[model samples]
Target: MTLAARAPVPGRFRRPRALRSERRTLHSWLMLPVEAVARLMTITWNPVDAFFEAVFWRDAKRPGKPFHGGWNSMAGRLARAVVPRTRNGAHVVMQVTGHHLRLAYVSSARTLTGAPGAVELGWYTDLRDVTWIRDRSDVVGGNHEIGFVDGSWCSVHFVGDGWSRMPDAFPLRLSHLDAIPTAR
Candidate 1:
């Protein structure tokens, strides 16, 4: 006797549509409070950080120490108060150039890992990278995110209005950078 061939059943290996939709809805509801808290922090703390940066840390040139005085001092306490607690737990410098995205941090004795200065560079051409840039505002400071091809992403949030430039720094040329195609 010959056996009859049968087609594979649909939705056998995947979750049901209704269940998937319900999970998505639950996830969105859970994330609403988190997003709200982040926005609240941005609105309240950004101005405070900006004021301290403009008045107290204006002339400071040190790389590791951003505050004018030591961490125990009043200026330092006020400065530190505005810094948002983040996932990485490190103060990082993020720069996006034409060819690469760079993340550098100065690690001191206070750091949890106790690692020293470290630098990480990822070339855009090597990965499918997407960047999200948020413009600075009076209440909220500017922030950026870089999504890599490996499904990993990094975000950087500024403590103050980053538009202000020091006299020695070169002028930002937005027009030239905008002309280049960023697609992978």
Candidate 2:
């Protein structure tokens, strides 16, 4: 009954097979009626400070694990424990620091957007000055098309395995890689 310890968000995973980019802690069993309408749409950032390596344990024998390279199926863990994927409306929160790559939204009824878990429509990249891509699709899903450095470009939606762990935490180029379209 003690939880605390999760790290890795400084751009390092060495992809060969990676999972989790860290500092992730999500929970929404309909967070108070979906945060009373997503806290009027949480604008983002409630972390005065953070560092989490990722972990979720539940082994009443076995079968409840996600720590590090997490990718599971057994019918997607019994259909995500009786349906609770929230269809991407689980109020996003991502942090990949070593400079910047923050996109926020967190609410424990803190009322997002001006302090207290906010980031209404935010994006701040610096993935070494952007210019990225890592597409994947089989039915139109999974992306990461940044192109910043002030040139402005965005196309995120990267779900699952984060495109096989963004070249082990950024270092991509080979036309930025893309080959997951068995017909999409």
Candidate 3:
């Protein structure tokens, strides 16, 4: 079946049957090692994230501010130092659904950077595609379904060590964007 034609399996986080099965098997095999590494990374990074959040990222719970000279700001510098960087510029679009958030990157936008035209962009819809999502008081980590406008979809897991530098970093990136509504 084509991507859009496929239905999500019934669950909190739905995924394609074939992909789910493959992931299940792979997760089973790698559980121990993956867990070990994840635990180690979390142990090492969570404290740093907390410190940074306490100092530079105090506004992490507020809606994100747009990326204006973010790199020059202390929060932006901390975000760059700790959070993983994407090659595409930082103009992300965010949509908050019930219990879920959808994010997309504006790879080309003249308004964002005063650059002309569009660049070839890659979309990430899954957990792996996003580095972090900061909610009030807590940082979430889990797998979620991600789909692109082109009808491509995948399941992505959150990186164990990822954390956001500002509460509003995500919302700010999405200020000018709209979420694509999905049928229940």
Candidate 4:
């Protein structure tokens, strides 16, 4: 048989299609900007950097534990705004001081700052109760649900925040990407 062109036939492999399971939903799309801003903030000010400097006996801006906190979810945002919740459970930012957890929030994007984690503020509580509930369904560890001492909880699906310097920041929380699992 004669061929129109004197070139060998190419492989019949078709272009890979976007997996149906990998499709993005409206919610995911909406969260894109929020996630970007979270990451940007981390780049602007990496709390972990200062943490390590202090650990090595280097002079730091604030001589204390590194900042530990992520953006709250929509629900957390509301509770953070509420006086009761803000005092007890809604913390977008926190610092582990000598005997208590100092919670703080930025002036903007207070509702959803970064990956969410909730801690119920109480008169007698320490970092021992800093709870963490990994999202087993999420193999990538992008989602984590913070369990409250009172049995309430909230989930956050953020990529992660840049707030962890050591492998095990008391409370045993995940770094999302920074923390690597040990191979047993």
Candidate 5:
């Protein structure tokens, strides 16, 4: 047969079998590492929600109490990620979920009693994308308060609840902070 008149074969270019095998191998290797990391970094909104509900809102089994400046008990809860300062006292930027509400409370400094710690307790509400925070006690007064909780914006302060009485120092910045291991 002359080269110019030769017919082309229809099935010669197809390779469907090789594509599936390559895809399967790639998926198997990627999945192993993905699974381990997923388990380590998994954060459930349920634990955070339940803790806030039990402490602030005070469900039926637990009655709410009254405090000084505003709300007497916890009413709601939301998720928060805290980034602590390094050993050299350098403040790290934390990815707080709310607006510019990413405030820090360092406790390593000594207080009036000559102690080397501080405690911070507050009630916060997450509405859509905005977050409202209210101190549980008067430990932090003027500098932290906004105004009265009327039509104007302000954070509530509690008077006498146990949570309202946070120590002047705390070891960790946030109670819910946990470390997820990284793979080598």
Candidate 6:
């Protein structure tokens, strides 16, 4: 067969275009950082582990604590809202920062929960610290940038106003795509 019409014949060896397409698309995007991380021996942001250590472990230390329960309740609501109406599910990653906490899910289609889902609550702590909570757009690191694998789904949510009020002044963002290196 000619080059243009060439195919991977059953008994013979030929490179598949689908394989090339996969490499050029999602696989490449995901692996670029993996390769860089493997070579450089560094991690820019470990959101998954960071969140578990920062939030989950703290909650386990104090069962039914108001803050813990509130976050869990909000997370569950966000998950139910963003997850697609299919057999597949999503992974939700929530981030807490000085200004506001943010959540983003990686999914096959865009899932956005705007103002209607926004809820604010206030309370006073025994430590005399006042608390203000709400869904805020402010986020840091790769907390907002979600990745999707073909038909996979993902999402995120911010539960508190955090330690600050002004949103524009916060310096947080998703990992830059250009900063990553390629893998073999």
For every model shown, the clashing-pair count is: 0, 9, 8, 2, 13, 14
- The 0-to-1 C-alpha lDDT of every candidate, in the order given, reads 0.32, 0.34, 0.32, 0.35, 0.28, 0.29
Error of 4 at 140 (Å): 7.0
Candidate 1: tens digits of C-alpha lDDT, residues 1-184: 0000111112322211111111223445676789889878866357888888878875573222111234333222222322322222234443445554333332211323555433332111321243222222222333222233333322234443353331112122222123222324
Write candidate 4's Cα lDDT for 1-184 as tens digits: 0101211222222111112222343555677798789978867266787677758645344332111222242223222322221211222343456554433432212234563333332222354444543332233233344333333333433223643221234455554343322212
Best by lDDT: 4
Question: Ten residues in a row with the worst lDDT in model 3?
Answer: 14-23
Instruction: Report the lDDT of model 1 for residue 181.
Output: 24
Off by over 4 Å in 6: 1-67, 70-72, 77-184
The model with the greater TM-score, 3 or 5, is 3
The C-alpha stretches of model 1 lying farther than 4 A from their native spots are 1-89, 110-128, 136-139, 144-155, 160-184
Q: Rank the candidates by lDDT, best first.
A: 4, 2, 3, 1, 6, 5
Task: Summarize candidate 5's per-residue lDDT along 15-127 as a digit string, tens digits.
Answer: 01111111223344566687688977765468988788768765454222221122222211111112222221211121234322333333433445775434332223332
TM-score of each: 0.26, 0.23, 0.20, 0.28, 0.18, 0.18
lDDT of 2 at 71: 18
Alpha-carbon runs more than 4 Å astray in model 4: 1-91, 109-126, 133-142, 157-167, 170-184
Question: Mind giving the per-residue lDDT tens digits that candidate 3 earns over 41-128?
Answer: 8674578888887788666553433222223232222223222223222333333443334443333224335664232222223332
Return whichever of 2 and 5 wins on lDDT. 2
Question: Candidate 4: deviation at residue 144, Å?
Answer: 2.0
Which residue pairs in candidate 4 collide?
71-113, 71-114
C-alpha RMSD of each candidate structure in angstroms:
22.5, 17.0, 18.3, 22.4, 26.0, 21.2
Residue 63 of candidate 6: its Cα lDDT?
30
- Compare the candidates by TM-score and give the number of the best one: 4
Top-down TM-score ranking: 4, 1, 2, 3, 6, 5
